[model samples]
Target: MCRNWGGGPLLVVECESDVSFSGEENIGLYQSSQWAERGFCKQCGSHLFYKLKQNNQYFIPVGLFDNCEGLVFDHQVFIDEKPKYYCFANQTKNLTGAEVFAQFAPPE
Candidate 1:
């Protein structure tokens, strides 16, 4: 829902597609019939995640974690598209739009 998202660090978790998370209250879920599902916390308006239904895999904003001690930064996608407002100090395999699609996009 937002671009050049929060200025703080974000944590992204990729898990097996069958996994799911349910919130007890103030939750929002949106989906398109065949591709993906999105969720958010309605009360606080926090973007929860984006899940690809075909694989049951989801991308979550890691800042949502209470404790993220084990997380590590490896590669970064859309590295070329990141706004000038932020920068990362760590060395990572930064990929541009074409590279990302080439590696992850399903064959056409």
Candidate 2:
């Protein structure tokens, strides 16, 4: 399990069969076509990253890092799915689905 932030390798976490969804829901503007693999902490059973199996990439919820020291989000995914209950006040880069794909998608 890796825990470094952006500009480095993405964090990878293993998932268990007994995963649970809290219904907290994620807020962002990007969605991958692949299924998200979920996992929980062995000791606390807390919610962890939703690993994207297709590219061996993991999307860790910002909440998981209680006291993140140097981790910075490169982009906010699925912002359209963001709930109306809360609002993000940060000044980080925000990218929509098409914008994200444009940069990440393979060249023609």
Candidate 3:
């Protein structure tokens, strides 16, 4: 379970494979218009959460939270870009690239 500094929603993700990373390298994807902030476990280097900069919302990969209980997903973004190797069996709303950009685009 992952929580922000304010102790609000607990972000959860299940890990499909082990992820190892050095502390010095950046763990997230960011650009001029979009950002996908990521958090990792310091001890085991596990990917924790992916946060959106536009709405201050977050999404957990669900793979890292295998044992996590009672968590809900509001939606899923980048469904089209999702890797073909894996599939999420849940029935949450999946957002396309254009839909996500329109909704989360930076204000003019």
Candidate 3 error regions (>4 Å): 1-34, 63-75, 82-92
Q: What is the lDDT of residue 5 in candidate 2?
A: 23
The whole-model C-alpha lDDT of candidate 1 against the native structure comes to 0.69
Candidate 3, residue 78: how far the Cα is off, in Å:
2.4
How many clashing residue pairs, candidate 1?
2
Question: Highest TM-score, which number?
Answer: 1
Q: Write the per-residue lDDT of candidate 1 for residues 12-42, one digit (tens) a residue.
A: 7665565566764777887733456777888
Q: Estimate each model's TM-score.
A: 0.72, 0.46, 0.46
Model 2 segments more than 4 A misplaced: 1-34, 42-44, 62-67, 97-108
Residues 61-85 of candidate 3 have per-residue lDDT tens digits of: 5565556566666566667766567
Task: Please report, as a residue range, the 10-residue window in candidate 1 with the lowest summed lDDT.
Answer: 1-10
Kindly list the per-residue Cα lDDT of model 2 for residues 1-108, writing each as its tens digit: 222222323432223334354643542222333443454555555546665544545556566657667665455544555457755566766666577556544544
Backbone collisions counted per model = 2, 8, 9
Global Cα lDDT for candidate 2: 0.49
Model 1 error, position 96 (Å)? 1.2
